[model samples]
Target: MPDQDLTVAVTGPTGDLGIALVDALERSRAVKKIVGMARRPFDPASEGWKKTEYRQGDVLDKASVKDALKGADVVIHLAFSVLGAGDKTREINVEGSRNVFDQAVRSRARRICYASSVAAYGYRSENPKWLTEEVPALGTDQHFYSQQKAEVEQVLAKTLERKKATQAYVFRPCIVSGPRATMLIEEIPYVQLSERMPDAVRSLLGLMPILKPVIPDPGTPFQLVHEDDVASAFVSGVRGVGEPGAYNLAGAGTLTMSDIADAIGWYSIPVPDLAVNATAEVISRVPAAPEKLTWVEAVRNPVLMKTARAKKELRWKPKYSGRQTLRALIDAWKREGPEH
Candidate 1:
């Protein structure tokens, strides 16, 4: 059975997904208290998180994380360092995770939920494909982000072998989307089309004939889950009946780059073989291509998650379908009237 009156400590509570988790836990009757930890002081006025206490803690600092984990029944480690500082990613993802695990052990926290990523699976070129929890890490050296994630998973697996009392759940979430999303076409740097494209772009592009590219093996198809659903899945994984392990939390249905572009009423452009083959070459010479291609591929080739375990074991159900979720994002973009 789950602990109903548990006090939960959520690391990275001020981030996009972290904020959403804080909000979900705050509204739950089962939760007694929520301890939100972050590097900067959380603004109550802007965050609107009530009945919660904020603590300033750095995951990189073991003492700081240990101090924050005091008296916490469950600790959800959501803090992640992606950009800036060369080794910050490994430091936060690996060393910081060790700190959290150490604190959980000291605090006698019953459960620990770690927010992992699909990047842990690394880059793959499989087909008719869906990545399951069983799929081993790709062991690719392409990016530091994926490498760190895979290493952290190995750390947790080894930790689990040593500790039996404390349960750990790792959630591998796909590209998360929602109303307040800062990614996608809107935030793409130098893509002035996001602003100058006009609201009529959706309708105007519909009339003009556009050619869609067809690739033989376009990788595993995936869709973005709403931030709310991702939060709910974490909460469910912590409270719901299940053994501690990894699970893929993704949106309903498999979608491809062409599918998403078509749904959003946009056209897909084929990257020439030269561009595809020499992506790194071009990225090295031309700075803009890296960011541009990153934005484009993020929407284009998302990895779909098999939600059977999440459904059967956790009884998790995504409230928003991928289509509806995308539509909401488009509507929100329309309301916001493009980037300033």
Candidate 2:
């Protein structure tokens, strides 16, 4: 039976994925009211979510976070920062997360769903034959984002140890792609084929024939789950239907960079070792790449993930395949003109 009259609080309500989750919850009859906390006020006309009550709060402020968690049955803490220098990352990702968890405990919320990242696993050279819930986290100090996620996970575990009754669920999602994605893909530095190459050149290369590529060589396997699937995972976690502790929320299928490029009706030539080294030098001089290639390569080479735990426990299934996802992205990019 649905948990009717359930009041849920979703932090970072205006964020890319947060908006989608709120929309889903608003449509659900199980939830009575959704308390959406964000830095800015909510816009009602955006989607006619009248049942949503907006609260302005900062996760960094313990008092503000504590107030935001009051009168909530479930707390979905999604407020996080991914930019700025080293100090800011620690401030928001670690300190802010600690504040949110502490408040969730204080409020005696039944369930707390945290949105962690696959980066918490750091990078692995030898891909696991099959990733499972039991896979130990191989965290590293190489990247701030990865390290911070690991630290936050530790804090939550400790908080659970202290509180004992509050059920803590951690979702370590992979490269998520969907309608309003905020990731490296959308902001990638690349020229449109139409702008760079003539139509004839595109045709001769068969780039326009496939519609999108299915798989490419140099096969650096990667996984990308749709945003909706991620939201559903959170909903399931809140309902106590999924694995209680940590689980990987990765896509159903895996594809290589060549495959992804091909699926998008483009071709990929492996950045030569020398070119990669030179590009690193250039990027380091200009601005650090959102995630260093070495960091990405460690995670991308073999993104082996198992969704069995999520499926059996949470009743979760991804509707979109990697190919379908890439096609949708291309179509959206063509129509929207990449303002996102």
Candidate 3:
């Protein structure tokens, strides 16, 4: 059980998962105060956010992170960079994680929870049918996001090995989905194209069967976890209920590119894996292409995992299935298309 009066500090507390986690904490009588550290101020309009004491801090800046974590009993490190080039993404994801963990140690925090991703397993055909926590997070070098995730896990592991008192909890989640996951939808290049066109033009374009045939097919098998369920796992870890170790987090279903297309009412043109990588290689050279595209080849490979560890250890049974989460995300995207 959690303490009756716990002061929890959450870094990157304004992101999709962060908001859900903070909301969960606020609902718990065990949590008395929440120190939300983010780069900007909280939304003044959110009643749920009003309860938190906002701290304007940057994880990239060690001193600021340390100051923000001073009196925290437990620190939930959610700061991450999902899309960017190598050096820029590493600056925030790798070095930034080190700062947070080091500061948590200096503050003598009892526990630290991290938001890791299944991408840490690395997208490869050789990946086992189901990954376990024992599997090292050594993603391929080409995928900076995957590489950074692995690097951060190494830092957390080393920190715990050196410090006897402090404990670490890492959740390697699959693609998380919910009403708040519109950001993921916006990341799709096709969706961005639709957003740029006029509304009438977009509607007309959607009706064109020929246009749908051109949609890129990302045939990789994947899993989806609800944002709320992930929050539950974190809450469980924070309350000293689960073992101090990494656990996979994902809902109870598997999906592929065709499933994603069906959910969003798009068409999937199945292409050979070789062709997909070839196209990605060409796009990598384009100046307009985001450096994050460097990982396209690696990510096209599937990395599936099971969540039995989280279920048995944390007693975390996700309420929403993977398909449910995907549907929710698609609906959210339709309602709030491409948030500025």
Candidate 4:
């Protein structure tokens, strides 16, 4: 049954997805209150959210997580690192997730919604062209982000199974895009540069086509779902509209690597599979290499998903197609990016 007039607790409620979710939950008649926990201080009223109460807390702090989540009927876990790889990041990704799941269960929350990624499917040579929820989430060893996502899912599963009273809805979204969430698009011009490089320099490079980094495109198609669509799926999870299981979320249609190059004003070039494979092979060997290199493996091996289950079960539909989402970002980039 879809619960109404509930207090929803959210971890990482100020992030890109969290902001959209906050808006959705604030406007929901079913949601009476929202308790948000983040490392930094935030005012929900700044975002025009009347029902949300903010708490300064870290996901790693068990006591804070527990205290912040008091009397929560639904819990949404959205806190995880994506760019860094080290003891701290891995600990936060794994143990921090464990903390969230444990507390949600301890509080006897009716539902838990976790934002997972298609990277959980992993960039493996063995992956099916279109992955379904039924497929195993055995994430590849290519990137820590992929590995940790899989690990967190395993933790959630075990905790939910043991508790039985709490249910979890796992949503696996593809490369998410929107005007507001420009993290991925911002990195496009800095592909060849070090991750530690300053953002100002990277933005300047993107402004000049000659200096812009060349992105290798093997012509593999990939999906980019709008961030709003992902928020909608989470809303479904919060409303208890879907069964307790994983659902793959993606926009209709697909875009190739060249399409991305065109979006950023011509930085795309056709690179042979052998070159990309050799680069990935080399990067994989350097265990101490920067986390950015970990994404190199994904260029050759794309993780595309089938959203039939989300549509059939949750009655979820993406408002924007893959092209529309990318196009919208391109429009926003013109106004906000280096070119501006």
TM-score of each prediction: 0.82, 0.84, 0.89, 0.89
In terms of lDDT, model 1 sits at 0.67
* Error at 44, model 2, angstroms: 4.0
lDDT of 4 at 215: 59
Which numbered prediction scores highest in lDDT against the true structure?
Answer: 4
Clashing pairs in 4: none
| lDDT by residue for model 3 (79-144), tens | 887765377667888888999999898889888989988988877666687898887788878778
Taking all chains together, the TM-score of candidate 1 against the true structure is: 0.82
Model 1 backbone overlap count: 0
lDDT of 4 by residue, 96-200 (tens): 999999999999999899998898887877777889998889887657888888888999999988687899999999888887766667653224433333444
Candidate closer to the true structure by TM-score (higher is better), 2 or 4: 4
Instruction: Report the CA-based lDDT of candidate 2 relative to the real structure.
Output: 0.69
Which segments of candidate 3 are over 4 A away from where they belong? 44-47, 188-210, 338-340
Candidate with more favorable, higher lDDT: 2 or 4? 4
Q: Which is better, 1 or 2, measured by TM-score?
A: 2
The Cα local distance difference test for each model comes to: 0.67, 0.69, 0.77, 0.81
Task: State each candidate's clash count.
Answer: 0, 6, 0, 0
Q: In candidate 4, what residue range of length 10 has the lowest lDDT sum?
A: 188-197
TM-score of 2: 0.84
